[model samples]
Target: MFLECQNINFRYPNGSMDVFHDLSFQMKTPGFHALFGPSGVGKTSLARIIVGDFNDYSGVVRSEGMQNLLYSYNLERLPDWSSVGKHLEKITPPSLRDRKNELIASFDMAETMRLRFSQLSLGQQNRVNLIRYLLQDFHLLIMDESLANVDERTREKIILGIKDMFPDTYFLYISHNVIEVSKFCREILVFRNSLKAPQVITVNGQDHKLGQTVSKDKLEQTMLEIMHAS
Candidate 1:
């Protein structure tokens, strides 16, 4: 098993409502997965618990064959004191420099590399921050709306490129874009509405790999299933 969460139940300190109630799920393999649900359904909270940010919750969140589980979100900011290129070059491992350059081109970020972090647009900033995480060594990465403001076309290319370049790494992508998740993720964990039995449903996605196209019929069916589950 890659990750297992058993009987997870949580609530904020002195808060009125429970965030999760007897939520249980597991990821049996390493690949791209998703956490899908309406807003405020404990998606982010559960991610934090998985990454060890919240230990106050009840349940056993365990992982096997996984180390360096990192979380990256859209709003994370890079330091503006240096140029984007310089910051990336400084932190990137020496052996991964070629891969870093390739990603810069793949993400269409070569032009913005010379600019300071604050000088880039919101979408560009998100891409730069994401690249920073990719340069590191991690077993699994939780991307919480990490590609938020990027254009759809560019986002697709970047996602496909990442899937190709890091075939061994695991990703738990969180996005509200139903079509995107249905087309790309290998598995979709759809959360049910609050107070509902069986808080989650695991649906198989198209799991489109690099240079592969998912049929429209299959894509629509996956989307419909996700929507109906939510």
Candidate 2:
């Protein structure tokens, strides 16, 4: 399995609410996966747990490689007024350092490479954040609505571009956009109920007792049906 979680349980400190209960699943293949759920249902929490951010949870969260990367909606903490080139240098690794120019060009970020972080639009900043990760290696990449600020067309372009650029890297994308999920993801993990195990929908041309793989349009329809039923 590329990633696995077993007997997971968690809640915030001094809080009466429970975030998860006995949640478990295993991902054997490497590809794009969509994690769908309403806001505040522990979607972000789960991402953080997978990336080793919050260790307060009780469970066995294992992956083929310990190295994981995460980018989320919150950009308030990002450096203000820092030159784009400077910011990129700080996050990019030494091994991938030489590929910085290549990545920037591929993402159509060359024209704004010299602009300050605070000067770009919200969508531009998010794109920059995503480009930084593309230069590195990770066992799993978690994007918690990192592209929410961007428009739908641009978002789709970037998402597809990422898939093409990093064919081998696994992605766990948290989103509510059904079309995007159906078009880009090979598997769907719907967290409809907070305490229950997530319902799985695979679109890798694999037969399963629950559902069968189909065309992107068919997959979208099937996903909507399942999501509404959930």
Candidate 3:
């Protein structure tokens, strides 16, 4: 067991309602894990909790065998750069970060490195948005709807690159599409009304269906179905 999260319960300080409760999870290796749910259902909340930003939560999130086993890079405040590859050199260790030039070429972004991030096209910026995380050597990689803002072509290319290049890396991916997300994940974890100790659906295959742990007759409609149905 490389990662363990047990009975994690949390609520915003301003509000008493819990965002998550009694949620348990464990991971042994690097593969993509999608955190899919409708808006305001605590997908961002879960990300914050996992990244050690929200310490007010109950229960322990411990990585016993792996020290500092989590890493996430988001679009907000993206490494401001006149030189795009500067972060590649400054942030990552030399031995592990030698793939800088290769990544630049692979992303088709070598020409734009010298220019500021503001100067890049939308697709170019999206590619750089992803590279920030790809350039690192962290055990758990989390992306919070990172591809939503980009073009379909760029998003597909980036996702393919991530899958092919980072085989050993575990990705905590986030998206709302039940059908689309299944392609990238081996196990589909469903969160229903995720702000309040929601049920989790464990799917056997990469089938993108509206999966629910609680039987339809046994449960009330949740944000998951509500979003899709609407």
Candidate 4:
């Protein structure tokens, strides 16, 4: 397993509540995985747990080597707005740094490379945020709804591009789009009831359980319930 957790648990700083409850799962070394749930369900929190930023949690969350690299984008704060390309260059190597222009071209953000991150459209910045991690050669990738700011077209482009362009990099994607998740990932992990706690791999496919293969009506009901609850 590239990443695994056993009986993991966590709560906020206040002595009030727990975020996760005895969650456990193991991940293979490759392919894309999707995590879907309503907002604030600890999707981001789980990503934090995977990469080790969130130590407040109990239980064992473990990964090797590139785990931290996989999660550099779930930032505690936003990237500086001075320059998108420059921010990436600081962390990325000169070799990968040179590809910035080409990536910009591929993502249709060439015009914004020199512009301040604040100056670019939200979609453009989202592309840059994605590219930052995509450039790294990590064994696993843990992410949030980082693509939520972008349009549907760009989102699809990224889903396809990651598969085609970076086959070796493992992707752990999180999104609220159930239909898109079905298409974008080989497996889906559904966070029903709450983001914290043991997530249900509602459908199973590929080497892992994808997630619950709900009917269209049930899926819609799930989504509606999720929206209403959180």
Candidate 5:
């Protein structure tokens, strides 16, 4: 197993309501997955708990065959002192230079590489920051709306490229975009409304490949399942 969270129960300090109760989930293998639900449903909280950011919770959060978990969000910013290309080159291993170059091109960031981090738009900045993480060694990455401001077409390309290139890595993609998650992710753990039993529902997604087109019927079915679960 890659990860397991058994009987998780949590409430914030000085807060009135419990954020999660008897919440449990597991990732059986390394692949793309998602934590999805309406706002204030504790998606981010659960992610923090999984990454050991929140320790007050009562639960057994277990991970086997994995060394580290990294979290990335949309609001994270890179240093503005150096050019994006320079920053990437400084941190990337010499052996992975080819791969880094491939990602830059695949993300349609070849032109912006020479510009400073601050010069890029919000969407561009997110992509660059994500590239930095991608070059690093890690077992799992939790992306919390990390691709938020990017256009749909570009975001799709980046996602497909990442899935194709990092086939062995595990990803927990958190996003509000239902169509995107249903179309791209392998499995989605949808959180139900507050006070509901079985707070999380696991649904199989389309998991479309890099160059394949998913039929509308299949995509709609996944979306409907997610909607009903939510």
Candidate 6:
């Protein structure tokens, strides 16, 4: 598996309910994978846990040496005065320095490079952040409803473009939109609750060592059912 989590458990401080209880998941293929569930079902929490933002939880999250890149809409941690280029430089690996311009041009973000982080629109922020993360060598990408502000058309365009542009990279896209998942992901995971194992719906043919089977239409339908049920 490219990513695996076992016996994961967590709850907010001073909170009564456990957000996750022995919730486990494993991703065997390396492509675009979409995760969908109703709001506040630990979707964002899981992303934070996987990326090491939440350390209070107990479990084993093994990536097998694969580095992860996390992108989200909130940017309060970022310096408001810093330009997009400067921010990217701060996080970018030295080896990937040369690919900076190429990546910017690919995302059509050359102009935004000079703009301050505070000056860009939400969609522009997402594009710039995504490009910056992609320029570096990362094995896994976890996006937590990061492009919610961006319109459906633009989000689809950028996401599909990234999938086509980087065939080998693995993506875990967390979203509420089923149509978007149907269009982009080869595998879809639906979370009904934190206690039970999420429903796995594979769209494409088995492409990994741990091959499995499912259909796109079926996955979309299942996603809708789960969402409505929740």
Index of the highest-TM-score prediction: 1
Model 6 stretches astray by more than 4 angstroms: 68-78, 89-98, 195-230
| Per-residue lDDT of model 5, residues 1-230, tens digit only | 48899999999999998899899888887788999998899999988998899999998999888787998888988798989999999999998999999999988899999999889999999999899889989899999998989999999999999999989889999999999999999999999855898989999999988879899999999999999998
The alpha-carbon RMSD values of the candidates against the true structure, listed in the order shown, are 0.9, 4.6, 6.5, 5.4, 1.1, 4.9
Worst 10 residues of 6 by lDDT: 201-210
The worst-scoring run of ten residues by lDDT in candidate 3 lies at 204-213
Error of 2 at 40 (Å): 1.1
Worst lDDT 10-window in candidate 1: 191-200
Please report the TM-score between candidate 5 and the true structure.
Answer: 0.97
Q: RMSD in Å for candidate 4, one decimal?
A: 5.4
Query: Model 6 over residues 126-169: C-alpha lDDT tens digits?
Result: 77766766776677888777666677766755675676667888
- Is candidate 3 or 4 superior in TM-score? 3
**CA lDDT of 44 in candidate 5?**
94
The 10-residue segment of model 5 with minimum total lDDT is 191-200
> Relative to the unseen true structure, what is the Cα RMSD of model 3?
6.5
Using lDDT as the measure, the top candidate is 1
Query: lDDT per prediction?
Result: 0.92, 0.71, 0.63, 0.65, 0.91, 0.70
The C-alpha stretches of model 2 lying farther than 4 A from their native spots are: 69-77, 94-98, 195-216
**lDDT score, candidate 4, position 148:** 67
**lDDT score of model 4?**
0.65
Q: 3 or 5: which has the higher TM-score? A: 5
lDDT of 4 by residue, 1-230 (tens): 36667887777788465566676777655677777767765677888777767787778876644543467443323356558767767768777765655666677777676777767666676778878777776677766776767788877766766666666666778887766666556656676543433454445323222232336664555445444333
List, residue by residue over 74-145, the lDDT tens digit for candidate 3.
454445644666755676567765566666677778888777777777667767766766766676767877
Count residue pairs with overlapping backbones in model 2: 0
TM-score of each: 0.98, 0.83, 0.77, 0.76, 0.97, 0.77
